[model samples]
Target: MARADHWSDTEIALTVADYMKMFTLELAGQRYNKSAHRRALLKLLNGRSDAAVELKHQNISAVLRDLNCFWIPGYKPRSNYQEALATYVEDWINSHSDFDRVSQAAVKQPAFVPTGVEFSTLLVETPKPSTTIQEEHPPYSPNRAASKRDYVAQEARNSALGSAGELLILEYEEYRLRSAGERTLANRIEHVAQSKGDGLGYDILSFETSGQERFIEVKTTAFAKETPFYASRNEVSFSADFQDQFHIYRLFEFRKSPKLFSLAGAISDHCQMDPVNFICRLR
Candidate 1:
C-alpha cells in the first residue's frame, strides 16, 4: 500500500462525513461497528488501504476537536492534521444545521445504576496548537466563536445537566468505595456543592483506597469529550494548593450513556487554563 503525502479534497470530505455519522450514532446511543464503516468507506476512496482510511478518520477526529465538536471515540484524536481538513469540517458543520440541533436535543437520563457497563479511561492529550490562526467566525471558529453552540458557553448555561451528571458521579464514588470495603469512607462522601455551597472549589469529597481524602471537582457536559469547560480562579488556586489530592472528573456524553475521564494533580499541568472572563468593578 502506497502512502500518499496528502489527501485529496474529495477524500477529506468523504472521511469527515463518515466520521460524523459514527459520532452521531454514538451520541444517539445507537450501536455502530467501526470496521463496517471503514470497509464501506474503502469503496469511495481510490484503493486506500484500511490502515490509511483509519489514519484519515483519526485526522478527522483531530479536526473535530479543534472545532470544539465531538469525534468518534473509536478513533483517538491524532494531531498535525491538514489545515484544509479543518476548513472542510467547518464548512460541513456550518451547512448542516441539523447536526447542532440533534446534538443539543434533550436526552433521557441514564439509569442510576448502569448495568453491563464497561469503563475505558481517556487520558487528555495536549491539543496541537494551530500554526495558522484563521479568521474568527461568529459561532464555530476553532479558537473562539461567539456562536450559541460555543461549547464553553453551552456548558456554563446547562446547570440542570451539570447537576444531573454530578449526582451520577456521586453514585459511582459511593459504589466504588463500598466495593473496596471502605463502607465507612463511602458514608463520609459528601456532595459539597449541595451541603456547603458552590463556594468550595471542589464538588464531591471522596477518599483514595488508602483512605486519604480526595478533593474532586466535577466538570460535566452532555456534548463531546473535547468540549471546553470553565474553571474559576478559586478552583485553580485550590487545585494548586492541594495538587496531590485534587482530581477532576470530566463527565461527557452525559444525557445519553455517560462516560468520564479523570485528570489528577495540578490543573496547570493538565490544561491550558486560558483566562476567558474577567471581573471588573468601579474603583
Candidate 2:
C-alpha cells in the first residue's frame, strides 16, 4: 500500500480490533504491554511505520471518545481521523457481542481508596476543548439498542464510584489544609453531601488557605482525562451563583492509579455546558 493511500477496510478493521483488545485488557485490570501489542499489530499491517500505527491508535481514542466510551490512557485522542475510521470503530462495536457487557461492568464497578497516591502530581490542568472542525453529524452512530448503553452517563450515575471519588477529595482537602498548618480548618471540613444531602449542588464543604469557604463538587471516571462528565442544572447555577467558592474536582482512572484536575470559579467558564435532561408536567 502507498504511504499516501487511504487505509483499506481490512487494515482499518484489523487496527480497530487490535485497539479494542488492548482497551478491554486495560479495563479488566489485566497486565498487557502496549509496546508488545504494537509490535504484534505492526506485523499484520502492510508495512505501516511505528509512528503511523501510534497515530492510528490515537485516532481510535478520538472515535471512542465520540462514542462516549472509555479509551486507552496512554493514547491521547487525536481528532483528525478519517471518516472511514469512525465507521470501522462502530462496526467493531456492533459486531462484538460482549462489548457492551464488558464495558458496563468496567464503568459500573465499585471503587475504593487508592493507596500510595502521589498527591503532589494528582492535580493536573483542566483539558481544553478540541478546536477540530466537527462534522455536521458524527460519522459513527450506534444502533437503537446499543445507543441505550451510554457508558459515560452510566458511570456518572454510579453512586459507589462517585462516593469513592468524593472521599478521596475529602481526604485531599484535609491534607491540603493540614499541610498548610491549618489544622483547625482541616477539622472543620465537611462531607456535606453525606452529612446533609445531595441536593446542595456541591459534595464537600472545604476551605481556602485564607479561611474562606470553598464548595467542591466531585466527578469521577475510570477512563482517560478528556472523558466528558454530566452536571446537574442546579450545580451549574450554584457555581455561577458562587463562582469564587465553587470548585470541580475531577478524578479520572480511579480504578487503577487515580489523578485529578480541578476547575474553579463558574463551571460554565471552564466547561461547555449542555442540557441533557428535561422535566415534563401535564399542561
Candidate 3:
C-alpha cells in the first residue's frame, strides 16, 4: 500500500504553485526581499494619471484590497512591508492548487526578469561537500514521491543542464581555474563513460589541462541556499577509494543563484556519510 505522504509530480507542482502565487499576492515582498519588484507590481496594478502615456485603467483594487491581509505560511512577515495584491478574482481558487491551474497561471504571469540589483541577480553553484549543519535533521525517506513526469524533469536538470546551464557551469569553471593559475579550459572536458554502467553512468570523466587525469562525478542541486546535497553511499565510497584521481563537485542553485564546492582525496579521509538512503539514490 502507498503511504499518505507520497505526492505525484503534478501534485507537488500544483501545491508549490499555489503557495507561490499566494506568497506573491499576500506576502512575497514580506517573505522575500523583493523591494523593486514589489514597487513595480504595485505600479502595474495601480495605474496613475500621467499626461504622456495614455492607458486604460483596470480596477483590481477590490480584489487586491481583500487579499492584502492574507499571510503566507512558513515565513515571518516583514514588520513594515509595503505589500502588493493579486489582480482579478477567482471564486473557486483558494490557498490550495492543482497542476492544471498552475500551468495556465504560469503562462499569464510575466517572466521573472532580474533587475541590475543584487537581489535580482541569477546565481549558480558548481558543487561541493560541506561539514557544517545547523538544525535537527528529518527522518530519512526514499523519494517514492516523484511521479514519472517529475523524475524526468529533475533528472534532466541534474544531467546535461540543457546546454545553456551547462555553458554557465563551464564558464564558472574556466574562471575559477584561471584564478588558481590553472589553464585547462572547460571546453576540453568530455563525458567518456558509457551510459548505464554497473548502474548509472559516471557523472563526468575528463583530463586536466596540464596533462593530468581527472575522474569527476558531479551532483547538481538547487535544494536550499544553505543546504548541502544528500550524498549517496556509493558517491562517498567512489570518491573516497579513488581519492588519488577522483573528485566530487557540487553545484547548487544553478539558475537563480549559484555556488560551487568540491571534495578531493580519499573520500573516507575527508568525509563520512549515512547508509539509510544513500545507496538507493546512487546515480
Whole-model lDDT values for every prediction: 0.73, 0.86, 0.38
Residue 261 displacement (Å), model 1: 4.1
Which consecutive 10 residues in model 2 have the weakest lDDT in total?
137-146
lDDT of 2 by residue, 87-180 (tens): 7887788788678778888888888878778777888877886676665454466554545567889999899999999999988998889989
How does model 3 score by TM-score? 0.41
Q: For this target, which candidate reaches the highest lDDT against the unseen true structure?
A: 2
Best by TM-score: 2
Lowest lDDT block of 10, candidate 3: 51-60
TM-score of each: 0.77, 0.92, 0.41
Better of 1 and 2 by lDDT: 2
Model 1 agreement with the true structure over 170-243: per-residue lDDT tens digits: 87888788889999999999999999999688999999989999999988776666666878898999999999
Write down the RMSD of all candidates, one decimal each: 5.2, 2.1, 14.6
| lDDT winner, 2 or 3 | 2
Residue 253, candidate 2: how far off, in angstroms?
Answer: 1.0
lDDT of 2: 0.86
